[model samples]
Target chain A: MEQTSILETRHLTREFKGFVAVDDVNLKIRRGTIHALIGPNGAGKSTFFNLLTSFLKPTRGEIFYNGQNITNMPPAKVAHLGMIRSFQISAVFPHLSVLENVRVALQQRLGTSFHFWRSTRSLDKLNDEAMHLLEEVGLEHFSRVLTVELPYGRKRALEIATTLAMNPQLMLLDEPTQGMGHEDVARVTELIRKVSENRTILMVEHNLSVVSNLSDTITVLQRGTILAEGDYATVSANPAVLEAYMGSSAHD
Target chain B: MSINRILFWFTLAVLALTAPFMVYPVFLMKALCFALFAAAFNLLLGYAGLLSFGHAAFLGTAAYLTGYTVKDWGLTPELGILLGTVAAGALGFVFGALAIRRQGIYFAMITLALSQMIFFLAVQMPFTGGEDGLQAVPRGYLFGFIDLNDNLSMYYFVLTIFVLGVGLIYRTVHSPFGQVLTAIKENEPRAISLGYQVDRYKLLAFVLSAALAGLAGATKTLVLQLASLSDVHWHMSGEVVLMTLLGGMGTQAGPLVGAVLVVGLQNYLADLGSWVTIITGGIFVTCVLLFRRGIVGELRALWKRSF
Candidate 1:
């Protein structure tokens, strides 16, 4: 195989008080592939995403990004190195206009984020580029609207647009289609597929249809452990995966 | 700027230029000083979403330092103000570093605790004149040519500094730095995930707000020729908060309007003595209950709805 891993975890483990949220689990994500992690509510998918993004520190484990140890790196530094994550909740600068939301991500690269004396007009140069990103997500029509007023689905699109502005090497989307209507789920699923063309995407998705539609590889986690790892068909057909989702009766 | 904004600023500039003739220049100067102070506080609370209950530390520190430098060291008024502002900025740097590690109510409590420490230091420091403070500090010449001793000259001087301070704030609020601050306020985790060091931005905002508050304090000391214990009291910090809350926390003009209303009320209600506090509290209650966005915030919202 010509594929190389873009991210790797070495026995990643996180324990909460006495309960292990993410048990010792080693996982690898191939470069430029859409990999989905699916698990029930208590299966620790959120905790795994948090640990991967450095939002939560693992009790014991190391994270390697692009083959370099990033276990101790800060979340912002992790993001700066081209690994950005989206929230389980829709995250957009609520009061800012949709266009301003994308412009801010682009503005960070100019090294003037700390220049207090300069007028915001300096950011006007990014307007065209921001609009281009918005257009990509089909949010150009809502550019001038405040993000807080956006519909749930549109807000998710705006989140992706901002993530796209970062041009990340790896995008970790935590439940990108969570709580969306069927229409929104499909729209966002397609959007993810489009954005994943040049970037490796590691998403935690409960929507099995979205996973089956977009994931090149699928990993099933059950109670902080990997229950199955393979392509959609192989993982779905696995008895353990079936029992985890259903009950032991299904396997019997 | 929009037509209405230009017109509004033009009106404000004209009123400020001519107000000393109609109203007492001293009273106007006092209001301007407090307005600047409130605006500075708003920068932290409103924009950065960090409620600092100890902002009076910055204000009072600058006032005392400016008073001492101008009175004892024989420094020029500008240099005195500069020293005071720089000292406050340094203090802000320290406070910000310590407090930025906390969030919400904990952050507010830490600032209040730190400021109480300063209040005690003010009481004990020999240079501070204790409760007597530094009184009768001369308003030295502007560049040794224009005498600030003249009330008219002093009024213009205070006015000029107030304008410059507010202008700097306006620029900051509309700048890239301000944008990041707003983002941090709106969502800290998202900002961090977007590769922004949110704590660093919060610290810088804290320092800028402290320095600006110091500038207001130094100017107030010059206008009144006194730096007293009242400046550093926790009450003063609470009053600044009231001013910002009354005006509107995040809006550009909210704190300014709040400061004027507050200072003006205190002046007119001086005959009531201790009752003034009660009346002020009543007004605050009313503002919060009826128009929680503050006067300017409500007005902006109304305008947005209407137009």
Candidate 2:
């Protein structure tokens, strides 16, 4: 069966103070595929993600998810529609126990009302589901530990686990392995791969090696526009992409 | 499994229950009410990181409503309190939505402005009885059986509500919703990227805080048999913030301790008249400058270091 487009954007443009941060960009993400958005620091990758997730409204554009126009929808409504985004920085609730963090997301997804008299612990199914997600992310052993106590890499993993509890049909991850050691990067990479098996994964990554190894399609962005878009090999050889990265390589 | 945690809570509960016997019943009751108010305030400031300068609006509104219902409308104490709580919740829904539109110092200022409006209304409104306030409020009967006219009875009633309110706050903090609020407080941009509706979480926290503040204020009016302008004043809002800060910002038991200490000081210095304000101001300055972590926060730090 031909895979359907899980997320698409048409002529998405976001401008701040008359300067186009993301100009006339179009994107199509296939279901059950890992799509990577690669770009230089100022190429508006973050702004693009913000627009898609409804964090920032686009100056002009249309966004569709599952064949419904969700342009400029609030973040919560978009999330309830089965599209979720994970931050580059760990966004886990630090004071809450690891299990509680996931449980909170699950509660939102489960449509549990916040009733003062009712005890949430009585909801055995929610707890079990949260634990299952934690196990999937390999953080089950740390379930009772407060999220703030978790190591940096494990905190990132917990964030992914929390997102899974939401049961999103499409996941947007921003630089999942941005600041990690080699071992941690590899572990998160594996975790992302496993998660992508169940949902459409779209990520912004600067790590070329990880992007080349994991992405089914790569979209290169530079100067608020698409530099190239194709499979890794095709995009890597593209003159525009080479020029975008090569010019910045000297500084590193 | 955790013996220390269990023992710690047990000890604290014992101390709280025995407090009325050792201290003046009225003072204890006042402290209990303020503790509840402070805890409610902490829900917004510590957990959600949304500083509200208008918390007094909720407290004072609830106090006035409860006083009116019980005194003029002849409603039962429980029903009157419920009306007060509901009124605060309604106010919270509106104010929280509007206040959350801004962040940081802007949020604080917006809340302050809104609260100041309430203060003006209270002063001008005849129902508030002008400067004299709604006085001689009857404690009435609890459940139409227990006589609250008795001092001991009133003390126990206030204590029960205080305990229940604190328990509710504790449960909320441990719940998933509370965790999400904390995440929003710590890093709003990050929480939004996580697909969490950060503003909604914040508004929810604010409402919860307001409702609890209402509960405290209503209970206070019954205990003291009056609802006065003192409850509606901006100073009341500042006092609650000082209590929470002195106890601890994010720690579970911090607000309670702070409320007790502040109330105890007020009682001891009651004869000093306006000097009490100067002393409290000095304490606030001292806490902010020298002991920013607060008494409970410092203790927690020391405990952690030792362990």
* TM-score list, all predictions: 0.98, 0.91
Candidate 1 chain A vs. true chain A: TM-score?
A: 0.96
lDDT of 2 by residue, B74-143 (tens): 8888899999998998899889999998988999999999999989999999998889999998989889
RMSD of each: 2.1, 2.7
Every candidate's fraction of true contacts kept comes to 0.95, 0.28
Q: Give the interface RMSD values of the models in order.
A: 0.5, 2.9
Best by DockQ: 1
DockQ of each two-chain model: 0.91, 0.36
CAPRI quality of model 1? high
How far residue B259's Cα lies from its native spot in candidate 1, in Å, is 0.6
User: What pairs collide in candidate 1?
Assistant: none
Instruction: Give the number of the best model, judged by lDDT.
Output: 1
Per-residue C-alpha lDDT of model 2 across residues A1-252, encoded as one tens digit per residue: 224998989999998998999999988999889999988889999999988899889889899998889996888788888888988777777877898778767766545434434456644577788888999989989989988999999999999998887788899999999888888989999999898877899999988888987999999888889889999999988887788887585321
CAPRI level of candidate 2: acceptable
